[model samples]
Each structure stands twice: as C-alpha cells, then as structure tokens.
Target: MNLTVVGLGLIGGSLAKDLRSKGIAKHIIGVDKNPDHCNKAKELGIIDEFQPLDKAVANADLVIVSVPVNATLKVLTMVLDLIDDKTVVMDVGSTKSEICKVVENHPRRKNYVANHPIAGTEYSGPVAAIEGLYDKKTTIICDQDKSDPKAVLLIKVLHEAIGMHVIHMEAEEHDRHIAYVSHLSHVISYVLGKTVLEIEKDETNIFELAGSGFASTARLAKSNPDMWTPIFMQNKKSLLKAVDEYQKNLQEFRDLIAGDDEKALYNEIGRINDIRRVLEGLALKRAQGN
Candidate 1:
C-alpha cells in the first residue's frame, strides 16, 4: 500500500515506522510544514519520501492525518479535495466532533474516517516517534455510519495491523468521554504543575522534594500547549462540564476534611477506588492482545 502521513510528528512518524516495520505499506510518503521534521523523519527511515500535500494525496492509497486539532479540518478538507474515491483518509485527532462537522456535507466525506488512537507520550516531533506506540491501545472510530464501508473496513484493518482494538462511537460521545478521561487529566496536570511552580517561587527546593507520585501526576503538564489548546477549544463545552464535575468533587472533599468527617472522607475514597477494577479489566484485555 502507498500510505501518506500528513504530519510527521510523534504520532505520524510513529505510525510510519510501524507500518514500514510490519510491512503494511510498500511506500510511506510524509507531508509536514516543518522542514526539520520532514528531514528528520526521512533520515530516520520513518517515511520513504517527503512530498507536497497534493502530490502525496494523489499517490496514496491511504492518507493518515495526525496534525493538531486546529489544523485538522483544513488539512482534511484539502486532502479530501485531492484524493480519489479509492483513497481512504483517516485522521487521528484528539477531539472529533468539530472536524467531523467540517466535512459532513463534503462530496468525498464517505472516503474519510474519523478516529482517535488513545495513545501517545508527553512528547512531540519526529525524534519522539517510537515503535509499538499503538500496540494494545484502544482506537475510537467515531461516526462510522457517516463513512463508506470500504473506507471504514480499510481503517479497521490498518488499526489491527498495528495491534489496536477498535470501538465505534458517535463523535459527540467520543468528545464527551475523552473530555473526562483525557483532556481533564491534562488540565489537572497543568494546574498541578502551575500550582507547584507558583509555590517554588517562595520555596526554592520544592521540585527537589517532589516524589514519584508528583512526577506521574504532573507528567502531562509537559505536553505541547500548541496541540492541547486546540483540543480544549474544540471540546470546550464537554470539557467545561467535566471541569465543573471535578470542581464539585474537589469542593465536597474539602468540606469533608474541614468538618472532620473522617467516615465520609473514607467512603469517598473507597468509592473512587472502584476505578481500580475497571482499569484492571482494561489492562487484562490489552495484555491478552499482546
């Protein structure tokens, strides 16, 4: 297969590496606005060659776009305009609803598949690309009914090739769910990091005193703001709802502690501990895939 990846950053570059390593694609073409990423990706053998957007789309049997959410709609529309019916276009963006709406009425909408690969590191650029990034990860294919069956099938096959389990969902639901599970995590981490940094101004050894738990909780704070800002903007309504719920929980916990309601606090923590069961099940499913 002739596969073209439009953004040669972490996700796109990693996909190219896996597709080539697994012999899924005969040729991998990359398109990126950043010359450094293009050169780095080609030098690392992540892609066979670099081509302009139109030229790449014209020659690709499959086009995988992994750009930031803000640029996704524009790049998707441009690629859709350039692709033939046989070309299957899929985007791996964080938020799905707005992008789906952007091309809802497009003539070539059937050729496009919208999905989110629930995987990545707190890193960017071609240099950050790694193998097995999608292995055992869950991929959410949104609004599959809007896409052509052949295109959707091709996407499912591609995801399976990289060892991803597929789930179908409406774009709105995907956005809402991810707002809590994904975006909210980032928001919390960023705030946590900001809070620490603010304190570090007065306490010089604040970071030095940090433990593994703090590092893990603050890790997502290191993610690219350029990528995250657009996602938060696109999923603002759902994200706001998630934030409100989180704040309510935080306030309740604070009141419990202030009132010395030890039993209530213990019960709340115990209730939250139920997530361990859900996560353990997901981990088992992923391990079975391996």
Candidate 2:
C-alpha cells in the first residue's frame, strides 16, 4: 500500500516511520504545511518523500490525518473531494464527534474511518517521532457501523499489525471517557505546572527537587498547546464537567487539610490509593497482553 500521512507531527511522523520499518507500505509520502517539518521528516527518513496534499492523496491507497482537532475538519474537507473509492482515509484526532459530524453526510463518508489511538507522550513535531509508540495501545474506533466494511477492516488490520488492541464505541462515549482519562489529566498537569512555577519564582532549583511522583503527574504539561487547545475547546462540555468534578475533589482535600481532619484525610488518601492499584493492574494487563 502507498500511504500518505498528513501533518507530519509526532503522531504522523511516528506512524510513517513505523509503517516503513514494518514494511507495511510500499511507499510512504508525507504532507505538512510547515516546510521545516517536511524537510525534517525526509532528513530523518520518516517518509519516502514529501509532496503537496493533492498529489499525495491522489496516489495514496491510504491516508492518515494526524493533525490538530480544529484543523482536521478543514483538511478532511479539502481531501474528501479527491479520495478515490478504493482509498481508505483515517484520522487520529483527539476529539471525534465534531469531525465525524462534519464528514457524516459526505458521499465518501464510508471511506473514512474515525479512530483515536490511546497512546502518546507529551511531545510534538516530526523530531519527536519514536518507534513502538503504539505497541499494545488501545485504539478506539467510533461509529464503526457507519463506515464501509472494507475501510473499517483495513484500518483494523493496520492498527492490529502495529500491536494495537482495537475496540469500538459510539463517538459520544469515546468523547466522554477521554474527557476524564485523557483531557482531564492534561488539564491537571498544566495547572500543577503553573502552580509550582508560581511558587518557584525565587527558588530557581525547585525543579531539581521534583521526584518520580511529581514528574509523573506533571508530564502532560509539556504537551503542545497548539494541538491541545483546540481539543479542549471542541470537547468543552465534557471537559468542563470533568474539571468541575476535579475541582470538587481538590476542594474536599483542601478542607481536610485546613481542618486537620485526620480521618477524612486518611479516607481520601485510601481512595486514591485504590486508584493507584487499579492503574497498576491495568499496566500489568497491558504488559501481559490481556
């Protein structure tokens, strides 16, 4: 298959590199509005060549759109007119409902498979691409029933070949779950970073004191704002709900600390400990390929 990867950022560049490394595509072409990304993707051998969007989609058997959530609709709109019946188009945007809705009535809707791969690091751009990033990750396919069987199967096969576990869900359900698990975490991390930076204004070496727990919790703060801002905006309702719940939890903790309520603090800490145990189990299950 000849694959064309749009955007050529962390996800797109990584996908292109993996496809070539695994011999999954006969030729891989990349498209990016950023000339620097185009040059870097080629220099790093992430793509066989870089071409204009029209030419790349014209020749590709598969097209992967891995741009920002806001930019996805515009890019898809531009390419929907050019995709052939045999070409399978898939996007890896963070939010799905809006993008799915935009392309729902298109004649080529059947050729487009909407997917969200549940894996990434707090990095961006072609330079951040890494191998094995998608291995053992859960890939959520929304509204699979609405997509053409052939296109769906092709995408399922492609993700599975790269060691991803495929699961299907409604777009609304995917958005809700991700708002809590993914989007909320990023928000917390960003706020935590801001909070710490505020206190560290005079303590230049405070970051040096940060250990594993702080590092783990604040890791998402390094994510690209350009990419994430649109996602937070697109999924505003769900994300706002998550943020409200998070604020309530934080307020409860603050009250416990303020009142020096030992029992309440202990109980709250125990509840969070249970969450740690659940995450540990998930990590183990993923490791064992359960």
Candidate 3:
C-alpha cells in the first residue's frame, strides 16, 4: 500500500517503520508541520519521502493522521475531503468522541476510521520510534460500523501486520475507558513529578532519594505537553470524572493514614496489589507476541 503519514513524530514514524518492515506499506510519504521531523524520519528510514499533505493524500492508498487530538479533527476532515472513493483514512488520536461527532455528517465519512493504538513509550519524535512498539498491543477501533467495510478490513489488516489485536466499540465508550486507563495515569504522573519537584529544591539530592518506583511513576511526566494538553482538552468531561474518582480514593487513603487505621490501609494496599496478576498476564502476552 502507498501510505501517507501526516505526522512524523513517535506514533506516525513508528507505524511507518513497522508497516514497511512487515511489508504492509510499499512506500511511505511523510507529511509533518516540522521539517526537522520529516528530515529526521527520512534519515532514519522511517519514511521513504516527504510530501505536502494535498499531494501526499492524492496518491496514497491509506492516510494515517497521527497528530495531536486537537489537530486531528481538522486534519482528518481535510484528508477525507481530498481522498478518492477507494482511499482509506485513519487517525490514532487518544480521544475519539469529539472527532466522531464532528465528522458524523461528512459526505465522505465512510472513508474514515477512528482508531486508538494502545502503545507508546514516554518519548516523542522519530528517534524514539521503536521497531516492535505495537507488538501485542490492543488497538481500539471506535464506531467501526460507521466506516466502510473494506476500509475497516484494511485497517484491521494493517494493525494485525504489526502484531496488534483489533477491537471495536462506540467512540464515547472508548473515550470513557481510556480516560481512566490511560489519561488518568498521565495525570497522576504529571502531578507526582510536580509534587516531587516542588519539594526537591536540591536537585542533586533527588536522585539519591529516588529509586525505581519513583522513576516508573514519573516517567509519563516526560511525555510531550503539546500532545497531552490537546488530549486532556478533548476528553475533558471524562478526564474530570476520572480525576474526581482518583481524588476520592486519595482522600480515603489519607483518612486511613490520619486516623491510624493501620489494618484498613494494609488491606487497601493488598487489594491494589491484585493488579499484579493482570499486569503479568499482559506482559506475558506481549513477550509471546500474541
């Protein structure tokens, strides 16, 4: 397939690399607002060449818009308008409901598919593109019934080629679930990093006090704000609810600690530890390339 990737950052560049390696993408044309990223992607062999959006979409069999959530809706609409009847367009934005709602009545709506690939590192740019980044990951295709069947099948084939499992659900449900599973984690990480930074005036002593646990928890805080800020805005309602629930749980823990309810605190910690089994299963699946 002749693929055109709209953003040559981590997600787009990574997809370009895997798709080419898997022989799913015959040639990739990159389109990025950043010329540096486009040049970097080409230098790294992530994309074959760089082209203007209009020209790229004109000849592409598939167009993947991997830009930020705020930019995705506008770019997707433009790409859909430019695409021919046979061409398929997909976006890998974090939020889905807003994008879906905006394009619900578009003339070429059927050509577009709303997708969220549950994969990434706490890194951005073409240099951070890993070869097997999407391996054994779950890609959610929201409102699949609204897209053309052939386009949906092509998207499924593309994700499967990179070792991802494809599932379908409503766009609203996808937004809600991801607000808790993905967005909430990032929020916690950002807040945790801010809290630590506020306390650690002596940066030199931070590393001495920190360990793997702190590093792991704060890793997502290093993610690009340009990307995350838009995601938080797009899914504001769901994200607020997630934040509210998280605050309630945090208060519960605070109350337990303040009231000297040692047994309650211990039991709560033990209960949360049950997530270990689920995480282990996920790790096993990824390791086995399921």
What RMSD, rounded to one decimal, does every model reach?
1.0, 1.1, 1.2
Query: Per-residue lDDT of 147-241 in model 1, one digit per residue for the tens?
Result: 99988998998889999999999999999999999999999999999999999999998778889999999999999987999999999999999
lDDT, candidate 1, residue 30? 93
Which 10 consecutive residues of model 2 have the lowest summed lDDT?
A: 13-22
Judged by lDDT against the true structure, how good is candidate 2?
0.91
Clashing pairs in 3: none
Candidate 2 lDDT over residue span 51-102, tens digit each: 9999999978999999999999999877778888988899998899999999
Report the number of clashing residue pairs per model: 0, 0, 0
Best by TM-score: 1
Better of 1 and 3 by lDDT: 1
Candidates' C-alpha lDDT: 0.94, 0.91, 0.93
Off by over 4 Å in 1: none
Could you tell which candidate, 1 or 3, scores higher by TM-score? 1
Q: What is the TM-score of each candidate against the true structure?
A: 0.98, 0.97, 0.97
